[model samples]
Target: MLDQFLWVIFPYLCVAIFIVGHIWRYRIDQFGWTAKSSEFIEKKQLMVGSILFHFAVIPVFLGHIVGLFIPAHWMSAIGVNEHIYHLGAVYVGGFFGIVMFVGMFLLTFRRINNKSVRKLSSASDMVVNFLLLFITFIGIYATLVTNNIVTDFDYRQSISVWTRGLVTFSPDASLMTDVPLTFQIHVLSAFLIFALWPATRLVHAWSLPFNYVGRSYIVYRKHKK
Candidate 1:
């Protein structure tokens, strides 16, 4: 019963809220749909942290898609054995995980320690930043310690299968029942982040400025000095 709620009911609830919240936010607060970047306020720390965070997060996001969505059988079908895949996932994923951790740390530090940045930060902004930092830290620990140094638990067979099942609307809660505690925490934290995403500045991620690619350039007229 507990497993059902945590693994099955909780995930679906978060997804539903994620979808509905984004739609409502888009319709009611279109003007607020921005990253609200503070680069103009403090360029140095923002530049370093933002670059590192974005650079590391893109590959990490793709890694999650591949790891959770793609089945183990698919990799085996393509001649990639379990050991090979695990090595790639551990090394590559671990590297970017560490990078992302650093980036998040810097960003969170700036947000909290820098009076100027902190003054401008809303409660939601601080919450999101610290939450991301926590998530990234746990992810790195799971990858390096649980997946690498500890018992050889093949999450592909359990967590991956369970995640795909959720997408296909046939989640099996038992699959997540015996996984390492770190992974369980990581997954739960991730869902929490997703639930908060729509209400936070994270919504700017979906607002790509594709129109800029085809739009005409701005023209400026000189004024007499």
Candidate 2:
């Protein structure tokens, strides 16, 4: 029952909330869709945190795509077996996970400690940062200690299958039942983040800077007197 709710029902609920929430927010508050960056308040911390977080997170996000979306059979057909996959996931995932964790920690610390940024920050801002930190920390711990170092638990058959099922609109909650507790928490935390994305600065992700690409360039002509 618990697994059913968490894996099946909760995922659908999150997606529903994510879609509806974004539309509602866009319609009601189109002007406030920006990230509300606090770069002007403190540049040094922002530079370090933003660079580390964004750069590290891109690869980490791609790693999740490969791990969850790609089926094990596909990998096997390509000569990538469980052993090789697990090893790469451990070492490569661990390195990027640590980088992301540190980046998040730095950003959170900067947000909290910097008086100017803190003055402009809201309760929701803090909550978002804290949630992200917790999620990243748990993910790194699961990768390093729980699965890699201790047990070679190949999640492809369980979490990956369950996740792919969700993507295909055929959720199988039972597959998540046998997954480890830490892995379960990581998945749940991710859903929570997705659910909250619309309400937070994360909404800015939808906004693309397309105007720069197609807009006219400025021309300053010299006046001959």
Candidate 3:
């Protein structure tokens, strides 16, 4: 089936392309960091942009936990019904989507609008973000407009099994295709995003924010030789 072929190829290609691209890119970056100047003249917009990006990350992280880790019963026991949860996911996810979109758009525009950053920004880099935003738009619409879309009640278990297989370097292909189309796009995009993370300024996600904001540093005196 075309869907099955796409499911397998999409992930496989992302991994391969990422590995090969990273090796090439790393070598290139060793020569210099090519990022550009700031676009926002106002401090407030920059602050708000940073806030939106980080704020959205919370619910994004929580959604991963709930969808992949929390059992349905646990959610129900806590008084969160299925329909309500799905609806909440739609609105909350949309809020985060819009926030992230604005943040990413501004950041990308800054890169293009600023001469120094524009030179460094590549076709593939922009492609990755566009893919992410497109996938996210699909997710928002799927959540808001669809029903009977997420019929797989055992998604958590499947995710656990797939994760273990991936860790073992013996991933099971059978389980991968069972995911719903909506979920498939989301999962694939997330994986591609992760693969691309180390390559972009997106690696800023790993840096300590407090350290960045407050110039916090841990200094330990070295023992005398």
Q: Could you estimate the TM-score for every candidate? A: 0.93, 0.90, 0.62
For model 2, state the Cα shift of residue 91 in Å.
Answer: 1.2
Worst 10 residues of 3 by lDDT: 31-40
Candidate maximizing TM-score: 1
lDDT of 2: 0.88
Residue 173 lDDT, candidate 3, scale 0-100: 62
Candidate 2 per-residue C-alpha lDDT over 1-225 given as tens digits, one digit per residue, 9 for 90 to 100: 877788989999999999999999999999889889988788887888778888889889999999999998898999999888888788998898888888899999999999989989988799899999999999998888888554656788889988989989998998888778888899999999999988988898889888989999999898999
Cα error, candidate 2, residue 203 (Å):
0.8
Give the poorly placed runs of model 2, Cα more than 4 Å off. Answer: 149-152, 213-225
Write one digit per residue (lDDT tens) for candidate 3, span 1-225.
564454455556677776776666666764432332244443454566557766776786777667665666788999998778776666776677677767656655554565655565677557755766676666565555443455543454565456455545655667867666665676777777866755765544433546566775879897999
User: In terms of lDDT, which candidate is strongest?
Assistant: 1
TM-score: model 2 vs. ground truth: 0.90
lDDT of each: 0.92, 0.88, 0.62
Candidate 3, residue 208: Cα displacement in angstroms equals 0.8
Task: List candidate 1 stretches off by more than 4 Å.
Answer: 213-225
Tens digits of lDDT, candidate 1, 108-176: 998988898899999999989989999999998998898765566888889999998998999999999
The 10-residue segment of model 1 with minimum total lDDT is 147-156
Look at candidate 3 and tell me the lDDT of residue 150. 57
- Candidate 3 lDDT: 0.62
